[model samples]
Target: MSDTLHPLRVSNDALDDGAELRARMADDGYVFIRRLFDPDAVLDLRREMLQVMQAGGWLAAGTDPMDGIADVSRQCTEGDPEYPQVYHEVYKLQAFHEAGHWPQILDVMGKIIDAPVLPHPQKIARLWFPKFTRHTTPVHQDFVHFQGSFDTYTCWAPVGDCPVELGGLAVAPGTHNVGAVVDHRFSLGAGQLQADAQDVPWLTTDYEPGDALLFHSLTLHKALPNLTEDRLRVSLDNRYQAADAPIAEHMLAPHLTQDAPGAITWDDVYADWTDDRLQYYWTERGGPVVPRDTSYSDRGFADALARAKRGDADARLHLERALRRDPDSDRGRQAAAALQADEAPSR
Candidate 1:
């Protein structure tokens, strides 16, 4: 971060009441801190995510094919091995859905969001994106690219120490309050707000494998190009929204897009009815991909679980709406269970 950045300070400690994390998010729209996962856990997840991507198959060209994984790694930390193709392959592995219910993510995330008091059923997944010279995420708000809205959090956790060489992320924090405005000259990315305007809370910090960074829906953020040859950047985006949330009309558009890639096999783990008629509401509520994406005012999350258990077709819409992102993930068998549960049961 430039020394000119706003001189605000965070506890950077293990977390007590979670007030510190919440306050920073409520006030700034973004927060960068360490300690989302342990060293060993981060290493393990890194290896697993890479392997999962390899198993998912790859696109003929372009990184968007691996955007989910790269995005997570960017939010967390990763480096590319070589230009054009740092990673042999990278993709959003469906396996991470199992991470949704992990105890580590639940206990830590629950504390931050004040769950139980808020009481969310909690869902999790890793959105991976691999990047290289030929494929880098263009500067754009996530809402611009995906069918989902910005009403949910995209908690980003690094699988390893994320240095600049490793495709570190740069953020224009607090600028999130400024809606999706184009034109870099007037955009925070260009750094030309008002003459007397406050310097954007810009930062380009290196995070350890276990560290995490959280950002809001409107925040201005982008991933650094993978300049490090041989290092691969693999991360996760844990999305969340309130239960019973509607499906984003934007997301369903893919069903309408002629050349859009194949659709995800949305599996509803909770017992419920699958209703394609149900809408997938776009959301951008969670704080960031790393910190506390959300904290409910009541037990809306609990009610959501009940709706899902009864066989709700749009569970993915709701789960993505209220998810609690996790860092310690290697779901070989665990992921299988989550995906299995997500499927509709036989009569």
Candidate 2:
């Protein structure tokens, strides 16, 4: 893909017309709305999230949390041993989860879906650090990560103003029209699976605090690298689907609960929350639960193992992290064997 990014078409004018909104979504595979949220409310959530990061030693000492100045030395991504320690703290914020269910978000999603919307219980936040481009989220469809239905939609919004250099999301127009999930391969980036975008043109913008980009589960998209010198890029990417649609079982748990040592349960996340309003709210309203398909990740891990044996640095690094994260698990043992095989002398 070229370094150039085309501007996203703004769909704010269609807010009142569900037909127009769904038509745009059908034609473009996405709807980008500016100021869909109150900027002040976004900034307030940014402060709350960043304050947690600051307390966890992610931000530069003495800097205001709202500034989001990273310390750099403390940088870690989703799979790293050190990441979930701080990430789960930010995850614990009541406001962080509430942002997913904001009425504006629900109304917009309801319009686009033309049905009652159910926000997935696994709310997500991307707390990215500067200069960590290798681990930037790769190009992929949401279905591979967030399965159960192709009708699912993802709403991504930056907590603060996000310029291009701070790693906001970009989507390939009309990619969802392909109608099915594309083949995905292992990647070192967030979600770990990457799709083949080939030559598709991508669209994005220097996102403001309240801007939202909503797209289909099959739409191709990726995060632009966070190229800033000393700042952190924080954003939210939450999933929604019709209230009656089937949802994967795993989507009901807290995000990153599968990661070891740093993993946290919903109770752990809710222990410090100020209210019970949103807690377990999905129990009554959640869609029909289906078993999560592990094929995507299983294939990705197999690819990583093969690449690691060939001395691919990124793949080897992924294997090493897996080994370190959990030495006794089946995949961890596979990773250890791959790394060991890679180091063996020639026959």
Per-residue CA lDDT of model 1 for 162-209, tens digit only, reads: 666565555666666766533321111111111112455556666676
Badly placed stretches (over 4 Å) of model 1 are 1-11, 52-95, 107-131, 145-151, 179-201, 244-347
Candidate 2 pairs with clashing backbones: none
Model 1 steric clash total:
72
lDDT (Cα, 0-100) at 291 in candidate 1 = 24
Alpha-carbon shift of residue 224 in model 1 (angstroms): 1.3
How well does candidate 2 score on lDDT at residue 203?
96
Quick one: best lDDT, which candidate?
2
Worst ten in a row by lDDT for model 2: 256-265
Clashes in each model (backbone N, CA, C under 3 Å)? 72, 0
Listed per candidate, the RMSD to the true structure in angstroms reads: 17.1, 1.4
TM-score of each: 0.50, 0.98
310: Cα error in model 1, Å = 54
Which lDDT value does model 2 have at 178? 91
Give stretches of model 2 more than 4 Å off: 1-3
